[model samples]
Target: MGTTGVRTDRLGLLLAQFDQARETAQVRLTGLSDAEYLWEPVDGCWSIRPREEAVTPRAYGPGAWVIDKGAPEIPASEYAEVARQAAGGMSVAKIAEDWSVSVERVEEVLAHTGEPEPDVVPVTTIAWRLGHLHSGFAGQWEWSFGERRREPRLMVDFAPSADLALERFWAELDRWRESLGAVTEEQLDTVGFSQYPYGSDPDDPFISVLFGANLELIHHMAEIAVLRDLWRARFQLPAH
Candidate 1:
């Protein structure tokens, strides 16, 4: 295949993944109510709140941003214990028993089959996640293709409420998506196509940048879907 043909094929595959990611995010957001979109199941979970009500004393870096309540970093000892068990060829059930977690939980982490049961863990709300998706698209597009400027759509600006957040998300995402069509094969092959300073743009090829963008979509969609599941379960909604 010629250079253009190869780049087009590569970009086509990434775009397919991008579409699937967006669909999965949309499905997760469907029927998400305003209350649940802003609900914080754990104290200090990063979520969208009113400008005045978004106070978080425990916040680090950006306050009340997309930071979610997270599992405490697992101890090195625990990681070593898992490694030890695996080296011993212990059964998953045995590993679970030794590690003080459910067999299902162990399997979930090992096989990556399911979301962990959301405990009183810190987590971002649907509104916050949606705002993040929009911001990512806008930020990437601006730096990579459009004029690189200091313009940034902050979470608080667009994510005051669930409805408005969703509206902005679609608008920004559509604009970002449409802009991809203008990227030529030569541009895709060129290194430093994006001068976005926050990431690998300084050294990596444009194709790597595209791959990184796809990774953002896939992982964030999965995370949002898990958060949606947790939100539904928090209210004891029937898992339809």
Candidate 2:
């Protein structure tokens, strides 16, 4: 109908989507054990780990626990094989078959050819997914609604255990929901309303940023649900 009405409708839709996704995730996460939270379905999955056990070049958070991010250290031996595979023109599928690994693993290895940084998406544990959601919400809230000075990577304290992680995750989600609830109709249409520096929030309308955030929550939470399902069914599957 009117500009105000449109903005209100858009905001309502985004909030409903976010709430639905969050509720679904929470339902899936119910009674999640520490073993399931930290379970890595395959080798080389990026995940949360004790500080001393971290293998990634950079780890986030200040607590005893850290989320794995940045370039992983590929062994020199693996690099040598990568070189040989490239030189021989081996198909990714063939390479994976020969190595007894997933095709995604072969692609990830190949992605490290020119750059040392992580360009490939690795499999992640539930802890890692939850950590990402927590940091994203915290960071956006700070830059968009708070002081806009502190980076969440340095400020967020990673939970040391599954129970603590779920607690903090819900808290961050509440903070983000509160911030969203305070936005006015005009603010939704205002470009640069969200000054989140890490993303395009400063250049796009606040509504766009909110939509993107909803998408992030929906997709990542769906992944967490699938991981839970896999964890439950792992014992029933025949050995490969």
Query: For residues 1-240, what per-residue lDDT tens digits would candidate 2 score against the true structure?
Result: 456664347788788788888898888889999999999999999898989999788777878889998743344456556557656676777566555567887777777655454335679999999899888888888888999889778767887578988998898899899889888889999988877765457756889899989998988888999999899999895879
How many clashes would you count in candidate 2?
0
TM-score against native, each model: 0.64, 0.75
Compute the lDDT of residue 30 as modeled in candidate 2.
94
Q: List the lowest-lDDT window of 10 residues for candidate 2.
A: 71-80
Error of 1 at 217 (Å): 1.7
State candidate 2's TM-score: 0.75
Q: What pairs collide in candidate 2?
A: none
* Residue 195 C-alpha lDDT in model 1: 72
lDDT of each: 0.63, 0.81
